[model samples]
Target: MPATLNQLGLPAVIVVGAIFIVWFVAGNELMRRRGRSLAIWSKRALDPLGGRQAIQWITLHSFRLEIEGLKPPFTSGNMTGLVESWDVPITWLINRLNGRRDMVLVQLALRQQPIRGIELFRPRSLLAGDARQLAVQEGWTTEPFEEFQLAAMPGATPQRLATELLAAIGPRRADLLRLALRRRGLHLTLALNIPNRQAVQPAELTGLLQGVAAVALRYATPAEATD
Candidate 1:
């Protein structure tokens, strides 16, 4: 190595590492586009690197999260997320960056039909951002829970729905974000925050998705009715 760099030692390494991380995190996504694409880009950057880490056994597991809302031929707006779960160092960095919220694979689904009414549940103070104000403007009431605050449309019952949702989600889980929509029914935002230094079984992730879906569907309207 260069004598100057060698003399700098750890400080030089830190500087070089920071620069490399920024470039890698930005990748082609940021330079090529603007706004949200950069966020998506970060996920993309994680993919191959995390995959490589997995192959080399540097990380426990990796997965690709792709969003395909439209079932038909039209491929208008699709997005993907790449995550390396169970990497202690990466997980710690991510949590610190995301306001200490447990890092997890957040999966969201929005439907067209309004099941009963809006049912929203959020923490007393969200680390992500402020709770959505759209519903509140249109006349939703906020009901406080033991650890979370729920906001539902005027006619909707927040307290009761929260009970049902909690019962469905079970205990010993990570953070959650629940909200309602206009005619869009009860949208869902569920995640699995557990990360460990071991391979994640496919069946395990499958079961988690299934459990989340079960809770979400309770407020979902039939497809025919939605159409």
Candidate 2:
């Protein structure tokens, strides 16, 4: 019996080893798809299986990933954006299974901030009406209209700006995105959500967001906003 048990263990170990290697390699590939820069913070912890999980987070947007390690401020120059990535495998898996999505949120510095009133233009899927985001959800009202709904708080929706928004959305990509304008920055969300992170295209997302930002700039407050 002892000899038979030992014989079975050898084959079982080989099969388990192969499975582990595949999982590790696939996980690494998914983590590295964006070509992240050297991590400002790398901490080692336990993985789901209670094994070693080594992960790093590159906080600053000052330097590019092409360069090795950290570069001084003189060489790195001005920072364009801040990015934070989560490499928790369990959290990623849970979000996929639960139908939750988290895409990159970009907050680019604006030359001028928007006013108190906010205009929310949403795709047809959502209620196309006006409501102040700061106000209580129940207190809000929606007067559904057009291809894209224009909702505003504090006053009537600006038809001129709404027209511009409609033009910005255009015919081709109108259905795929939603735009929300606040006093300081614009928030753009993708209506299409995929289960896997690797399926997301960073370049496409960045381009769409930049286009939206450009359109919003026309309405920017002429003077710098006071804090």
Candidate 3:
């Protein structure tokens, strides 16, 4: 019996190894599909706002996945006019993995517009437990509206300006803003107050934000023309 057991050990190890490989591959693929689907869905949802151009920008600037060691992290960004929001899906995922069922801080951001209000609806299962309670207990408030003055280079349209801004700051947060607005039935443009807020003369804040957006956009989508 001992001799027989020893002989089977190698085959058992091989089977276990095979199973692990399959599982890893499956998990990785699943993560990729989920990320892509999220990006597509987000883009479609925002398509009505500014047409295909808006959709394209949103899709291009949307979600990103970061895996550190064995843990996986997901972040989504969106710009509603000028207000950018970022969703960190990883916190919820991590909490779920640890057996906590509650909506974590899935979205956070710094914006140049006032957050009228925030409401979390139909949170995913991973973010299901005590989200409302947690939000209330923590007294979460969106960042205050900031003012920026950007110089319109030559003939920069509103869309061009928006695109330039997004380029400066990696689109992950901007995409999250888009998702938040959709979920809350809010208008992205109104939230950011783009028209009224764009100052004629450049200021420290606007200059900084625009500069950052310019650099980031160049890095993320270098070939895209800008005004």
Q: Give the candidate number with the greatest lDDT.
A: 1
Whole-model Cα lDDT of every candidate shown, in order: 0.42, 0.39, 0.31
Error of 1 at 108 (Å): 4.4
Off by over 4 Å in 3: 51-124, 129-227
Q: Give the TM-score of candidate 3.
A: 0.32
The stretch of ten residues in a row with the least summed lDDT in candidate 1 is: 49-58
Give candidate 3's whole-model lDDT: 0.31
User: For model 3, what is the alpha-carbon lDDT of residue 31?
Assistant: 46
Give the candidate order by descending lDDT.
1, 2, 3
lDDT of 3 at 125: 26
TM-score of each: 0.47, 0.39, 0.32
RMSD of each: 10.7, 12.5, 18.5
- Which sections of candidate 2 miss by over 4 Å? 1-21, 35-56, 59-94, 97-102, 116-178, 185-210, 223-227
lDDT of 2 by residue, 119-174 (tens): 44443322223233432353434444464455564344455655565565444243
Residue 216 Cα positional deviation in candidate 1, in Å, after optimal superposition: 3.6
